[model samples]
Target: MSNRLLAIVEVSPEARIACQANGCGHAVYKRIHVVSINGSLQVLGSECFKRLFGGAIGGNPAYSSSDGRRLTDAERRMLQENTAQLVAQLEAEHEAAQDPAREKLQRISQSGIAREASGGPPHRFRAPLPVRQPAAPRRHLGPTPEAIRKYEAQAKIDVRAKFDVDPNLPGWRGLVLQRITELSKSDEVPD
Candidate 1:
């Protein structure tokens, strides 16, 4: 269970958005929905959100007069195009609102005589942000394919040498033969 509340952000008449929940990465385009969690807003397709939270949510009341159903592919595409245009418009408005010099001039003008007499800009200082160091690279110590093959070849030679010297050596012979057989079958050392 997640301790999260569904706070719908932006709604469009035709657009859909992807779900924000973990492991439920479904694309939702019809009844495009957005929610806020921990003060951060996210766009989610409405149906999946309702399924997870469990409620009958009548999506976007502006289009409620029309039949409540999924959007056709053509409608979805048109809506997506509309949504893109809307997003571009909103971004332009936001950029206009974020003009620092205009905002500062407005603040100074509003302050009137005392600020005008001072002449210098208002005393506002911000500390330099901290720099982050990159992490160290990891070292791999595992044996390489060539090294493994060399070891196996050496093992086979040593085992054969021992067996050739004394083939009837009771305990050693069977074990050496087994090692040689295994070495024949594999190119690398066994774990």
Candidate 2:
């Protein structure tokens, strides 16, 4: 069985679920559920889960509560608030990191040095070029409708004369008519 971590969930201490990891049958509040290729579930505690999976789950190794008990509502709220604060701090740092490049671009644009070096007018004085529409695609140079009709009519007459069968008739007569039509189509002028 190819065992893999599926989910981590909080369970009530009263449920009394025991870790399935070898040599570790501790009672668990935070249960790590593992599913095998054959669709069997095995539950393990955080410590045992880490040992078995070699810390593949990532994130902080510690459980939500210090003693591995289910967290209180207040503790959950505090954790969320702390997480939000950390995210805001990271975003601020990212903005600060980009400040130098932003400042350089701003300076270049304001000084008009970039425009002068590129031999283009300053931003305010420049006018946009007229958009040239693309030319329509050329079509295949084929026989005109009148020429195609004339060829088909002549072919039908020739087939009827050679095969001694009405081109409109079914069976072998229909095949002759089809061959005549294909020959007429092939007479179209090439591009």
Candidate 3:
């Protein structure tokens, strides 16, 4: 509290600097800023903050209730609303400047000679190029999960059926039978 501007560096807010090199005794709260210049409380900046702080109690980052604690959700929502409004104002300012800038560029282009030719050799024109259009996006195709599972199960059954050893032919191997069945269905492979 002792080092505070309102307490230690009491200066008339109307004047930028006090007549006294140490400090001023006036209580005016407009048109001046107080800074710790040279270890003394001197009016240096603008009093815009002082005048605005009265209405900006809710906007103050240091502001707290009588108990000096953090703000509630309502306070946070208010701050968000205020910030969004300020951003909208700044965006509108940028949007307004674009039109004048384009107009100025257009005027400069019309008056200026865009091309300068130092007569050496005239550039040769190339033959007409074919117009190319962008191709359509590709699509992926695949068997559905149920269909794939069914096909795999069928293949497994075929292997099991062909691999079963027949008692009539003692030399007949199930592996050989399976190979024959696979060769018979060679055309059945999917593209």
Candidate 4:
């Protein structure tokens, strides 16, 4: 005798019916109606329906308490109230998050700087102006060309003095002076 859920009906509080599941005979205001394969109708309570159908009516799972038990009428009402409170709190938080950006856009629209490129009236839909900072001062590294020339000229004088003090020094001393003279005349900067 296979049976399937037909419908869940809500009856008057004064007309409660008894559950028909195996050993449970509790009276209830809401009753589940099921029809057997042989066309027999049966009435069951919420808890009895959960036991017989594994907490589903027509392939849809029924809401139950955290302990897997079906909720009472009082518990269902409390759940709905808590859900409404949470939704209101989330909406308030989202509005608070958007306030700063909205304020900045409003300020830009009020200011005269956000005018249209075509010399028309200022647009209320323009983007906020970019904040620009002043450029930093640049620093110069290494010696200047004039400083290099002055140092090379002084070096030539020092080398000439060394050669005069000892005439037997290596001939590389003259080549060094000649290279210094060539460097001072050229425009290329040393690495």
Best by lDDT: 2
Worst 10 residues of 4 by lDDT: 60-69
TM-score of 2: 0.32
Model 3, residue 149: distance off in Å is 0.8
Candidate 3, poorest ten consecutive residues by summed lDDT = 1-10
- Stretches of candidate 4 off by over 4 Å are 35-39, 55-191
lDDT of 2 at 177: 52
Model 1 ranges with Cα > 4 A deviation: 1-17, 55-191
Question: lDDT tens digits, residues 39-135, model 1?
Answer: 4444455566666555443343222212233445554453345544433443465467678878998876677655556795654557878888788
Candidate 4 vs. true structure, TM-score = 0.28
- Tens digits of lDDT, candidate 2, 45-122: 677766766655543322222233343444333323453343334346557878999999899677797777789876
lDDT of each: 0.51, 0.56, 0.39, 0.52
Measure candidate 2: CA RMSD.
Answer: 15.9
Candidate 3 residue-wise lDDT, 7-64, digit = tens: 1122233322323223444443223333232344333223433443444333322112
Q: Report the Cα lDDT for residue 104, model 2.
A: 94
Q: How many angstroms is residue 184 displaced in model 1 relative to the true structure, after the best TM-score fit?
A: 99
